[model samples]
Target chain A: MKLSKWALALGIFTSVALLAGCGSGSSNSSDGVTTVKVAWRATGKGDSMYRIYSKKWIADFEKKNPKIKISLQPINASEGDYFSKLDLAMKSADTTPDIVNEDTFILPADAKAGYLEPLDSYVAKWSDWDKFTAALKKGSQGSDGKQYGIPGTTDARGIWTDLVVTKKAGLAADWAPKSWADILTAAKKIKQTQPNVIPFAMGVSTTNGESVSMQTFEQLLYGTGETLYNEKTKKWNVNSKGILATLNFINQIYNKDKTGPSLSVVMSSNYGSTIFQDRIPKNQVGMAMDGIWNTGNWSKDGAAPIANMTKVLAFNLMPTEKGQKPGYVTMAGGWSWALPKNSKNKKAAWTVMKAMNTKQLAVTRALQEGTLTVRDDAAKDPEYLKKPFIKEATQALQNAHFRPKNDLYPKVSIAIQQMVESVAAGRKSPSDAAAKYATDVKGIVGDSNTDTQK
Target chain B: MDASNVIKNKPHKTQQQKTERRLSVWLMLPSMILLLIFFLTPMILTVVFSLTNLSLTGEAASSLHFIGFQNYLQMFKDPALATSIWNTIVFVLFSAVIGQCFFGFLIAFMMRGKNKTFRRIIGLIIIAAWVTPEVVVGFCWVAFLGDNGTLNMLAHNLLGMKPVAWLYTFPMVSIIIANVWRGTAFSMMVFQTALDDIPQEVEEAAVMDGATRWQLVTRITIPMVKGTIATNIMLVTLQTLGVFSLIYTMTGGGPENATSTLPVFMYKQAFVSYQLGYGTAISLVLLLIGALASLLYMKILKVKI
Candidate 1:
């Protein structure tokens, strides 16, 4: 009886240990052929369509190099979840993928965390390295002065008008807003004419995360000719005339003019998809201040594809505050192809990463996805400029601003979201919100690190 | 005379001792190991991690240093923390304490001496709601209370009323009601078992006297199941405090963070902002709150052991 009990206990222990052992990572290499693992976001409807391009890129690469096999690690999640999950995965050599479809917004943090490998050595040897514009190249560089990634596509944010509603509202579909007043006037006109449709769709809730900061809030702040971080002073612009003016503009739209979408619709977690796929395509929105990539949303093979794209939507430049020195303004955040530091197949990974960022592929992705090509040559390609919206979006880039590339940026962004969200919710006045923002940012980066402007 | 017999029995005595030792080891081994790995280690690590400036990303992520309760201090200054605590308190009080417990006990009490078929039918419906996944329940409530959902549709068609924005307008009320609906079944089932265990003669004796229904219940039924009531409350309170999925699936702590409870706030901090230390501190505070509530329940109810 004792022997039987001992035997059972040992058997249970062994089975449990074996179960634990089963979690060992799979083989990436076999029979002299390397399998390079690639990680990218392929979750939502519009995002999943990017996989069609990636699949073709993989097939073409495989045909060229039979010894190299690409294994795709598609993460089906929101942007924030993807960032966290990718960081968790890349923390260990056993789980990290070889190639990564990285957002440049988080590249500084990732590089600073030692999760990404510097690709300067690889880029120095590549002939197409110089084809990438200086600004685009700088966007992919880490604070350590190391080239961390190759720019995939950079996008600009602007005003996207729904002609279906523009015509209904008695507004000119072809008109470009030269100032904040122009957009608000158009929004009010739309509001008066079409009571059912949303006058202006802008993300302001924390649920929309960076979409509110970059696409909505920053678009206005950058236009005010104030940088989020002072490049020369090397201190964050905690409170400034530009910030106050920007918050006042947010106040005007959300409170004074009441042109933005209802707080209920704007505050929901799925507002991004709601505005992009439903409101814009369903002709329920008059004017949408959004990123350039929304052009793909209404394409033939996009998320909410409509019959006549040109007839339905019109892209216009986001003009500066009162049409300043740089007349139009836009904020650009580009995605890039990065190599994980813990990648097992380093050589094979570089080959796959290179294939992912070619001149032809960049142009194709830009046209298909309605994002600006990072490469100077690809941007000028006749095939790329075929889309008229793409041409207009490119002009917005002439006065584009990039987010402060630092580790503290992600933390600071939360404070900005809170400050902006509070004002939008009518919980605080614009001046009060800006003052709170200054205090919040001061707490984050310390007193000496912040610069206040009157 | 027994010296030779004593020598002969020595080997058997040793054998018996060895067998008894093996028996205990075999019985306790699996559970002890499981407790160490799953429960103890994680608890200790969470406590340790809550003390550090450990981040999930950036330069701070790679090298975690002890910040000595700085996260705790900083948490006090955060406006979101205050909102989350208030929301959590209101959610727990209404949904669990008053809503679930009250309705569950009422139904269970009402059915105490009722027909067998009636009890089973009610039981089945309640269990069905409980068995459905939390996410499914969330989605169902969202559909039912949504602007163009069944509830609004019925209200519009029947009463000629405009479709009300239920979730957006009243996030807390919406989540609390849905949570009560989902959790009442557990409390009901517990109360049913407890109520059934009460001696029939005791109730008969109470009715034999000149006692009203309310008097009989307050004096007898409640007194008899005091222990079970306390235990049930403790269980449901802790369970409700950790509710993440149901609320996350429905509101996503949205409409400008109005519905963001402690769990939602912790998720935003840890996963979204990648502030692991601050998030861990929030979780620990949440755990303490749970512990404090349990202690309070046990103390007020005077539950023995």
Candidate 2:
């Protein structure tokens, strides 16, 4: 009896083990078509736009080529966390996605790290390569002179001011500052006229981190003709005269209390969604140094629809230091679609990337999402040109510059942020803060490798 | 004749005994192997990685030279690391020791004979806060305490005052409040169970000897639950030492790294700065801190077990 029972148990265990094996093996090979996984940012599960577009695009591509399948894995984390998680996942070959949506700041870093594959071979064969602007193309080039990713869209930073608030301060309805002094004077006037309303808003807290460094500090620095790193010399510039001046300007704005929101209010990530979605629409803020995409949140499909956005709001070019030639300056950066170095199905991934960068797809995405296209054809398309904000932002982009793409940009940016925060907090004089920043940057980049242009 | 009988008996018993012992060891082997592979291997890898300059930047180092104590030396030189370590120490002392334990014990002591319904409701409320997602909790706190947030709105509209930036001015304090609110329930639950396990007879005997409620708690109840308190302190200290989400979501370790603990700093280095080696080194230091804390607690408790 015991021997028969043991035999029965062994037979059952073997059958169960075989069934498990079959279940695991079913997902491995399916009809000889490899499944390529692609990851991108989506707002949430409730947003059907991404889902619908992805499904239709996949179906169309599959019909054209029946031997490949693409699986879309949409990530819903915030921008920062999404990038961190994506990097973590991409660390291993087995778990890496075939394609990824990368931010402009990270693309160069990832390319330098060998996380991305050089797409020069593919770009050479691609017909649409010539359609991309030279500057936009340069944005995707790594230090090794190889193209790593294809730029999808770019945007410029500008002043988003409330016309009503400007008028309340006796400023012009079409108020546009031609110089840094003009901006400060107007801000002071607004503060005096409407003590209740915040006169100016710029992000300058560590919580805001790179956003503060880019959108606020770099916007000012670039206008002053100061760049974070000198590409020619391949060294970081922390002690530039323009940087000190920019620091002083930030210090005056915050210490003098002539700005829109408090340091804390300006630093919060929700500052964008909340100020634009709730506060600015409610007429609480006078001016915001924000991206061109603010109008996207106030259109008919926006989170808070402002019927009179064009009339009530005004867009202005961010002014250069003294309103010199190239009167107004702006900084532009864009996100790209990159292929992981370890992607199993490179051809299929390349097809999806090509589809994503097509003129039609780019225009549709730009129009639907208010992104500025990197491709010349898409940029000049009637669909994009018809959008008023797009036209204005595109004109502004002519003088736009990008952040120095360096592996140490994130650290350098953090140092810049700390100095900005110190100035905003009234804890240090601008010159002192600038000196400290130079020292800090020198420490990070090493003395031999750094050059501070004073 | 005796020697022959003894040899025969030993041969007869050998196969059965050997089979039984083999089966028993085989039954325990799988679990032992799992513990060694999963738990021990990763820990050893972490230690090894901590000593190397293995960053995510994908640069091939000229050499993987073992520079003994170099990473730790660099940790001391990093301003952010020093600030984070200070913040961690202060946070542990304030939030865990004073906020969670002391206040938790006080509430539990008061509710010892209070209405059961009140106790249950309070317990559920505290647990609810503890169980809420860290991100949601961070958002709620930011909404309540931020500039132009609910608190500022109330201060201006209802109290007729100027708005104050709670998050910017008092970032560490704001996060400490949030951490304390979320973590106090754990201490409460621990103390509650420890109190329940205390013998009623001991308390009754103290009462009969004319001991007051405070005296009974001080002398008898506290001593009985001392071990639980020690364990709770060790656990919560380690947990709080590694808390990244709350501060990241709320302040991003901002207002000049005022609220940055070691974990946040380590994460910013590893992920944001892409300095995996430096970050791993920081993590190793954090692990050492936790271990030292546990050992200190054990020594103080002097628990034989």
Candidate 3:
């Protein structure tokens, strides 16, 4: 009996160990080909569409290139968590993906860490490199004087105003403010005309950190001709007159004008849903300072598909102060595809990236995903410019400023967000907030490293 | 006869004893080695890493400058760090102590004399929630309590009132509700086991003496489950102190850092701010708090075994 029990235990243990071994082995050898792994973020609408589109692309690519296979790993985490996970995975060669989707802001920092490969040589050899625009090329270049990634899609930020509300407020249906004063005056008029509607919507809550900093604050800062970094001096810039004026304008919006949603509502991740699904369709938000991609959700198959959105809503270029020649300013950001330094399949990854950036592919993705392409051919394509909102956003791109493409830009952006938020909440005056921001930026990049030339 | 006795005892007995001792040591070696490798090694590495200036960004720093207590010093200076510590303490005291343990014992006591079918149904319902994923629970709670959520919809459409932003106005309370909903089941199961172990005859004797249900419960049942309650409190307190998913998903330490607990703060510092050394310092402090809480609970419980 004792011998029989011992034999039974050993058999059970052997079977369990074998099963565990098979589980891991099967995952590695499912397709009998070298799988090139890729990681990218998946949002609510983008995930479903991208999955369907990429599957088609992958099948076609695999048919031509028989030896190579693609395993697209979609991470459905928030932007911050996605970056953290990707960074952690890149720390080890075994876990690193062959290709990574990175934000423009983090590309320089990632390159500095030696986590990403410089693609300058690859670009030099590629015949299609000239198809990319100059601004897009500059945006992808790192401080090491080497290009680190291929800029995929660039986007512009602007105000999405309800035409009906604007008309009610005695403003033209195509009202485009030329200065800070014009925006405030329009907001006040809308507030009086539509008592129940929020006249302006600006995000101040920390929950949507980078979005608020880039889309909301930087839009205003650049409109005033102040920027986060002064490239001429290679220093962080925080104590500019434009920076202080932008802070005061945000404070007035929150405290004095009371034209926007409360700070809490602005900060919520569901703020997008509030504007798109609840507020805009319901005509409860007069004007929303949002991205060009808002129209993506108003299409026939969108989450909140409003058929009248084209007539009831209009896009306006976010106006520059004093109606400058371009007449508007915008903050532009984009995503890029880069090869990790440790990726064993760097050559294969570059080939896949090259195929993905073909003029046809770029135009198809830009139209279907509502993304503005960085390629000149894709941007100027008749199919792209035919869309009314896209036409307006493209115009804004002419005056749009990219975030400081420095390694310390992310930290500097966070400091700017916090300073703006503090001012908006009436916790600090504009001068005080700018002073605090200057101190924090000085600490982050060092005092001697920054010059506010403006 | 003496020769025969010596022959019988000398070789086999010594060999058997030596073999048994060797076998026992060999049996324990694997587990001991595994514990050292998995637990002790990482712990030592964390301690060492906390002292250095290693960062995710891989910025240049003077290597391993034995900064003594400089990291800890910096932790105190961080405004976010102090707020996180306070939030953690409040979360542990309210959600773990009063919400989970106290309410769990009350429910357990009430169900002890109830019908078997009813008790099973109620227990299953609570367990179902406890087994749900933390992130799912957070999302559900946010949907229920958001500004234009079900609660506000009810307040506006049915109750004829202005909508309230539950998450914005009371971030901590929202998290507490979610944590309590998920965690109370554990305490309930613990108390159930302890209550079952108590002899039924003692309760019968008290009942026959015409003692009221409340009186008997307070006097007999309360004292009987005191040790179990202490143990449950300690376990749950430690578990809740490390909760990151719920708060991270729901508030992300926002509405002005209203709900930033220690673990979330550590994550923000390490991942968000890329301050790896300072984050590790916060983690060490969190570990110390957990250790102190466990020690205090053990002393109070005073289990003889």
lDDT scores of the candidates, listed in order: 0.84, 0.79, 0.79
- Candidate 3 lDDT score relative to the true structure: 0.79
lDDT of 2 by residue, B1-305 (tens): 69889898996678657655655554445555556767898888878877777665534121344566667787888777878989999988888877888877877777776788999998999899899988889989988986668888988998898777787788889988998988888888888888888889999999999999889989999999998888888878888888888889888887667887989889877776656677889998899888888888789888642
Candidate 1's residue-wise lDDT over B176-242, tens digit each?
A: 9999999999999999999999999998998999779999999999999999899999899999999
Top DockQ model: 1
lDDT of 2 by residue, A178-247 (tens): 9989888998888888877778888777655577888988898888777778888998886788898898
For model 3, the DockQ equals 0.25
Question: Which scores better on DockQ, 2 or 3?
Answer: 2
User: For each candidate, what TM-score against the reference?
Assistant: 0.94, 0.89, 0.87
**Model 3 spans > 4 angstroms off:** A1-33, A46-54, A239-241, A262-265, A277-284, A300-310, A321-327, A420-439, A447-454, B1-34, B58-70, B153-159, B200-220, B299-305
lDDT of 1: 0.84
- Each model's backbone clash number: 0, 2, 0
Ranking by TM-score: 1, 2, 3
Docking class of 3: acceptable
* Candidate topping lDDT: 1
For model 1, residues A184-229, the per-residue Cα lDDT tens digits are 8989999999888888878888766777778877888888878888
Question: Please, what are the lDDT tens digits per residue for candidate 3 over residues A235-269?
Answer: 77767888877888888788898887865477666
Backbone clash total, candidate 3: 0
The numbered model that scores best in TM-score is 1
Off by over 4 Å in 1: A1-12, A15-25, A46-57, B1-18, B158-160
